[model samples]
Target: MGCDGGTIPKRHELVKGPKKVEKVDKNAELAAKWKYCALSQEKLRRPIVACELGRLYNKDAVIEYLLDKSAERPNVEVVAHIRGMKDVKVLNLTDNPAWEGERRNAKGDCYEDMHCAMFICPVVGLEMNGKHKFCYLQTCGCVFSDRALREVKTEICHKCGDPFQDEDIVVLNGSKEELEKLQKTMEERRAKAKTGKKSKKSKGVETVSKPSEAKVSSESKPGLTNGESGGDSSSSDSVPGPSSSSKTAKPITAAGSKRSIQQMEEKSEAYKSLFTSHSSAKRTKDQLSNWVTHTPYHF
Candidate 1:
């Protein structure tokens, strides 16, 4: 055993170390994020859209997802947050003049550039290949780089000249932290809209009930007057009230019954006895005399 081949092992060789993390190609990652649709994994084309969280997608891909949500898709998680078309904004892109299209290498004659972009920023002339930060206006759908907006600070859009506020700016392809912030802002806006609708409904109900309450009060006024005046017809008739025709009720038999004139405080008792209903108006046959029928001149 006298050290024939140095059989003693080092601690570094005996124990295994953690594996090194693999690095993703930066250029390929950028190409995937900017050039390909998040939902369908297809090449980005005209009428591209960006969601509220700033994830880019093809317009056709989003529509397909909404049409058949039960169908299987490659990237279902990417579109899980999008509920409808309103959650996304169609991008307004500016074409790059120098870059040729897919047929640029039709003859296979020259070098192909993978970094070249189809669109560029209208204000700063920067190619939108994920190297420069870009944002779109929510009001006009115009795209511009962050540098252009920072250098030329104004409320008006540089591309469309339309007026917009700070809240209307939405960044394209934002980071995770930025997306979380955007998600919170969206939820707050929806909550506020719901509260506003509820308040309007309550106001409408109050307005409808006011007329009904006024109608009930008007009908009750005539009843109180009739009770206080001992059913006097003249006094009850003088008070103005709503017409009885509007109510869905038939006239009661008691409504036609009139109080005897003797009960009326306004008329004299002597005048009340002249009515046929009074006891003085009746006479017995034995007590009847014919003196009033004879005229002295005619006799």
Candidate 2:
């Protein structure tokens, strides 16, 4: 379709035979998919004109096409085009490390969920002859670009020098300083990584070391000690009664034979005399001699 006062030939007019029919089918399928997706999402709305170019194109191919076709094309405009353009909740283009020019940037670690729905912050774009040929912008899941706002006009792409006009293009942008900073930061992180300084600390972790055990009470308790070095006083206190070996002992009796209380008393006296030591006997005898007269007839 011709626009901007140019007597341009129709898309089919440029093709011949099966090529023309193939282009028509591709365009028709793209249009149908775009419309269907739009109707399904009521609140988010849809682009007035949606196309399915990405279906037949990979990201690298799409980028190369934009750069080549738009090069040498006069008045070229760069528009924002989304990949996987189904009910897109967020633009996951940032997840592509190849486009970001750095591995860290590709991770998309700093972005929020809504960040994807916002402007194409990373600005995926076509770099041509050391200068950016196009830029893409997005807001509220709506993709746009500087070229899209401009009047439609054919322009030669800066790189390939091909005749082209820009509409609904996806261009990413990043300044040299921003890229350099990102690169330096990534390097710094890499250096730190080599040292193995980073650690994964959990929520309750205050300091990483063996935790001290709870203190033992002054009063003895099972399975604990009171800090004394006497082989653990708890050991002697809890020792079970003598093992089975000590349980086989004979019983003791008050007398040699079953006797009256007087006989038992005489036996006890004899046993005491036999068991008493000579020193104790001498002491008892001296005390008895002092307390009693030599005539012991009174006894």
Candidate 3:
């Protein structure tokens, strides 16, 4: 198979092993179900995780801004204080309060509320300690900490790999026990694989990548792999004509560097001509008093 960006290490490559056709089929079924799981807006009554409790909107905003700035400089962790279980866990109402006041008040509109059970594990990552943690948020929302409040783009946290809630408060670090359990589950799965039996570990809604599916990820474009190295430049040349080259290749000529400026000047001249004609055509009908009314007067 062709490599994408980074070199595909030999270790990650799957060597010949006994095929677990049954498990593969099961995983395929699971993948299909996973696809369907994302299609609905309905909420299930699951365990109430403390992190899903209500959010303090301004606190979240400040935390997110700090996190973006803290990406370059390590060691800073955004920390927040948690009072009790209600603070940690929350019931995610299906009826999003954010959209509340948009329409006219109608009777019995049935804006239902549902809860998603989620929590923040306390285990810290290599870059920072466990002291700075935020509450659980929607997997798509932010988790605040000492460095900054970060939005959890994926279902899992980038650092600790914990599942966030739809509206859960999150701590930066997961509990040590939770990390140990995660590791133990992974180890158990590995061990069970040797015996040709499926592992009993909980799939607990964490996002795990399948090697086969990842090899053909639509999100990862054809020329690029999930790595830092640049993708194939030849594909960049195939678009309509030479335009893609300007988009893909590095700058080599002064003409290329000044192309945008030239385009802007041409656009500005066209706009000026249009405006001049437009004003001159209407100059006779326009009144001086209309413009003078808004002007500041000295006397």
Question: Candidate 1 — what's its lDDT?
Answer: 0.83
In candidate 2, position 17 carries an lDDT of 52
Candidate 2, residues 37-149, lDDT tens digits: the string is: 32222122222322222111223333443556645532222223332334122322222233332243555667522111212223333222112222322222233334433
Error of 1 at 254 (Å): 17
lDDT (Cα) of model 3: 0.37
What is the overall TM-score of model 3 with all chains considered together?
0.15
Q: Which candidate comes out best when scored by TM-score?
A: 1
lDDT of 3 by residue, 124-214 (tens): 2211112234443544343344233343244565445667543333432245664455346535644667555423333422225455567
CA-only RMSD, every prediction: 17.4, 29.0, 31.2
For each candidate in the order shown, give its overall lDDT on alpha carbons: 0.83, 0.35, 0.37
Which regions in candidate 2 have their CA more than 4 angstroms from the true location? 1-178, 188-197, 201-299
TM-score of 1: 0.68
lDDT of 1 by residue, 213-234 (tens): 9989766554443346465545
Candidate 1 stretches with Cα past 4 Å from truth are 1-17, 107-109, 226-299
Q: List clash counts for every candidate, in order.
A: 0, 19, 39
Residue 148 CA error for candidate 1 (Å)? 1.1
